[model samples]
Target: MEDEAPVIYGLEFQARALAAQAGETDQIRFIVGTQSLRQENQVHHIDFDDENNVINKNVFMHREGEMWHISASTVDKSLLTTCYNKTSESKAEMRAALWRLPGDFDDVQSEDQSSHQSLSLVCHLDATDYGDMKSVMWHPTGDNSNVVGLADNHIVVWDIDTSGNSAQMTSSAGLESKGQPKLTCSSWDPHHNCVQIATANDTFIRGWDLRTMQQTYVIENAHGQLVRDVDFNPNKQYYIVSCGDDCKVKFWDIRNVGEPLKVLSDHSHWVWSVRYNRFHDQLVLSSSSDSRVILNNIVSLSSEPYGNLIENDEDDDDDADDRESREASPPQDGVIATYEEHEDSVYTVDWSTADPWVFASLSYDGRLVINRVPRAEKYKILL
Candidate 1:
């Protein structure tokens, strides 16, 4: 069995330090994909010092066959400046400055979505129209060029053109059904030609046709509590998984509106985020307030137990052998493994497009843990 170790690509943290007589100062540091998990581990520290005169937030990365880049942002009352580090030295310097400015600045998350090319989309959370910028998803076509943003109260589409500009293609308002409010998490359907968009609110998962801007389907009471996260499998678009404050992860078949295909109730607390692995439709990664990351196997349609899940289980003595056979069959899907690394609530978890086994987790404590998805083996007993 050949398994590739996980990649620790980037890390962001807050670090606080106290000087002899200078008092305290807080600074943010980001370590890029330079050192391996053992050496430097791509972890950065963030913090604010006592002086409060200057605020420093920096982004650092050492790319393969390339020079290191460290970006810095300093805050002062109403002014903010961003500059890049261009020196062999790791500390802030004068000659290595790349750019400077005066304006409001927000933290930029790591961007490299895949090994081929990196993609990034930014939203003004405090801006009037965008409001909160709740969720974001990349176009499912694997183009990595376009993005669809679900904001405070709007659905905005950005088409990445050749000139390096994201053109806003469309924006839609909210719905007032049973006080369901507006969209929170939106995704481009993976099974189709990016023609359908699915969004979740406090109570419903609604589907809309991109061509007609009409509701195609709606699953009400999708989650008993506030639907916190929803995601479409990159490989299985018709199927989606949603987790909520209700403390349940439900799998749904968009075509079958009545009920979820399966309900995976393992997390002890609210499920905050869920995502499908780019490499395998059967593999999924989910994070929860329980401080654990769960790896699940989504049963394929080809599996017999899948179809029978929504079917009645009625067996007579004459069919005893058949029932035994069915009992011996493997599960529709099973828990592959669980990574209990984060000490606090894990807020976000993402799979590496470059490596299938590689995944990363971010927690409320600001600790980022990157590791490989371990493989599981089954043991059998003969009678």
Candidate 2:
């Protein structure tokens, strides 16, 4: 049989948020960020075929407010929401509300009610407002009722009740810095009993223990410039990765806060986002200001024996040979593939939670590309 061709698609409005629904392989959703002369900001749902062709799409407009960040629940695939920071001459408030999915798939409707019934507000917050909200994320575990939002220099946690009718502030923590850098990103550690949260601020990557509400660790000078994104390895407890304005992607072991385990400098411009494949821990995806998306194999560096050297041979000559063996090995965290299909700066790249080989990238130029990692390269495993 002939090889299947790759599938590609583009959007007219910049995508501010791109999320692949959990347990879904053929459909993904995004929010249009930039308002155009002809088109207003809207939420879009798109479906693709096996060949990667766009098959279906649904678009809806949010007339009440503008959205800055969006997050979907993993436990309940039907729930997706956006956070808005409304600033005006009189007051500045931040709130999060659900996006009513078009059609009969609405989760809010009762069994006896029709889908056309008016949608109700899911969450409203007035006491814990921030100046400029940057990012928001739903907790990976639990019932997905908890959410964390990054604004200014503080991180605020909120718990949504089962009904989604009300949201309550659970806790808030301030970033430890002499001069507060804009909090750019935040992520939850996926491992069990890992109450750790990671945040990227300016040139630093800091970790916090939510259990005690204390700063657990800090890696200073994490990036040459402001760090734009950070993600923890879902399968590994102590591993994390970050990207920033320095145009470099760096990996770190959270247990050792001194230095990055590996630095993958492939992008020629600012790197905006880095995400690890939830299933394939060794694979990472990154998008850059150079208008390109790159996939990397992180298995090599992750397999290295760091701080756990076994000294079977006690002779000095044997020890020297062992050191040379370690030094001669080629660095593992290298760029495996690059996708330069975006016309503008690629802002976000998200891997499908259901399929390890399939991933998506969204750019500031309003292009969204769904791609599958090459089959030939997929079988290579680190021995």
Candidate 3:
């Protein structure tokens, strides 16, 4: 396969949030929300077509408020969640809610193209009157019925009844200390069948076991500064990756958080996000305020470094060639690429659900750049 140029798309408004659409493999789709308090905010649906090397888009109006975050639902292809800024009693407040797309979204387009359809309302998530809603995370598994909302000093799990278009809080835990330290970020534990969650509170990484609504583990000072994002290793049971303002991306085996399994100081500024490839845990991505996206191939720490190997008892020659090919590719344990396509701070980077080699990054300036792994690197392991 030949290497191709990275595809770039710009939005009309500035943005900081993006999420790859889930449960679909036909098209490379991403959902982005705009942040503009002065004008009407919008939700952008971007589709990247690899065969033609082009992008297709659809825009929907979000009349509620300025958007801060967006999350696509895995169980329902048409449903999504957002955390938005709104004016409540002459004060700015953030809230979370579920919105759905029209059934004919794929085929529907206006004649003028200027008039856009508004997102259908699914439900409004319940939150404290004063706490600022940071993000609404869907379950780690395919089930979207249960969602956890992280806000100032609190983490709440909600039971969403999409059929009735309503949400009810099931359980919640508040951080109590000398000063109520606000929660920063969190990820649902996929290893525990989504019964536990790992949250970043300031510099601390705390694991919450939802079965008993109790704290299971706490990693004090996971980072020197505020933790920005945490993601679970999809293939590994207890492994997680975290990044923070310290400009370090640390991988941990949640069972023992005393020391990180590996630490990478690749970004010069604050590391805003760290993600593990859903299929290949060794492939990691980190975005930062330095306006760069770093892709790392972490081999030894991954569950499988050389892909699945089947020992052959009959063909000695075939096995030897296989071994040589694996050796030649040698697991690259360090940074592979630093993408500086965006001039503004990159808050999020996500791998495409449709294509493993393809991923996208969103900057604060509303620029979306979709890029792929170098073909030479992609063929190293395959050949």
Candidate 4:
């Protein structure tokens, strides 16, 4: 008997291993990073494009005046990308700039669309005092021109109004209580008119109503271990899903706080990310620490999952219903699709709003997949 090569996408792929027997067979070799902390540890951190002059480690888009501005997150210094028309062809190339600031943000008002048609630098923000920003998000309204960020677990909401001087209006939350760590993930509720945001930590998930400045809802012990990601359905306010180091993807109805509406336990390792397809409420996609992506049908929890079936009211002489009840139904199997492309752990996965079938995945081994979502074509497109 002879050894065979590994396969990918139904085709055999071969690679040479560092250690091989004298005349036996070849093996696959794995490469280690030269700039690694420990030779065996995988270091996966965010990296900016070296070709671009901007030095900020993170980037986001914000609206100012009548155009849109792309900004960077930097500590002690302030740099911004040039402005571009909100709906024009030249919006793609506006590169970001970096500098110092006087306060939280720069007052750059929206411009008049008819007269000020060109995309250029309208103004700059004073981000020096903002301090180590862990994450940033643009105002979803597209008119208020506010930018929100999380720093040391404190939320900073920036109002980009010009009457306020170089620095603009700022609001802070979650700062009263000290000794709080930065919330790892902050997600805006797309279903609530985009006026609410939710944050996740080791033991809890907190929802904040941006317009009311109130803590809307809190899920205690969202996971026994750290909750890696939290997401809300685009049209369902009563529902949310969470995944974590516990290796479980839980679906919650918010109505019940004691337990999840359903607990999916199929992943062999910790779940890194879980996403609901906005186009279809019944389809959920998840990426895990097992180096695989799983697609699941969300309707398995429903009372009448397969829809109404014709029922015969007449009693049968053979007692068929009694006999059928004695046979136990099989346990639920979670996975609908399993993708095993990445050689390392998959960290994140997101579905495109413009194209639901198209999704993206980022992995610890520096692999990015931007193709049709697995089994997306088989499911109904609800969007």
RMSD of each: 14.6, 6.6, 2.2, 15.6
Best by TM-score: 3
Q: Which one wins on lDDT?
A: 3
TM-score winner, 3 or 4: 3
Show model 2 residue runs off by greater than 4 Å: 1-4, 23-39, 85-95, 100-120, 125-128, 162-164, 302-333, 381-383
For model 3, the superposed segments whose C-alpha errors exceed 4 Å read 109-112, 307-329
lDDT of 4 by residue, 1-383 (tens): 22111122110111110000111112111111111122221111112122331211111222221111122321111322222212334542211122222222112212222331222233443333544444455443344556666654666676654333343536777733335645666666766567888877666787888876678777888888888777776656667888989998998876676788888887888898888876665568788879887877765543224332223346645467664653334223356666777676777666544455545455555554443544433433221
Q: Is candidate 1 or candidate 2 better by TM-score?
A: 2
- Number of clashes recorded per candidate: 14, 0, 0, 12
Worst 10 residues of 4 by lDDT: 15-24
Question: What is the C-alpha lDDT profile of model 3 across 1-383, one tens digit per residue?
Answer: 66798899999899988999875567789899999878899998888989898988888899888888889887677889999998766788888999997643457543345778789998989796539899988886666578889888888888989899999898888876557888878888887668888998889998988867788888999999999999998988899999999999999988888999999998999998888888777889999999999989887888875555334457556667787775677655987788989999999999998888899999999999999987876765455
Error of 4 at 17 (Å): 30
Residue-level lDDT of model 2, residues 193-226, one tens digit each, is 6477998888988888877678878899999998
For each candidate in the order shown, give its overall lDDT on alpha carbons. Answer: 0.52, 0.70, 0.86, 0.50
Query: What lDDT tens digits, residue by residue, belong to model 1 across residues 1-383?
Result: 54434322223332111001001112222222222322221213222221332223333332211212222211212111111122244643211111221122233324332332211222211213544444444454434444455654466555534334224445455555765475656667866777778888886888887666678999999999888777787665588888888888888888897988888898999898787766565677788889998988765632222344432347444476666676667555778878876777877676544345555666655555565655442111000
Q: Which candidate model has the greater lDDT, 1 or 2?
A: 2
What lDDT, from 0 to 1, does candidate 1 have?
A: 0.52
Using all chains and alpha carbons, the TM-scores for the candidates as numbered come to 0.61, 0.81, 0.94, 0.58
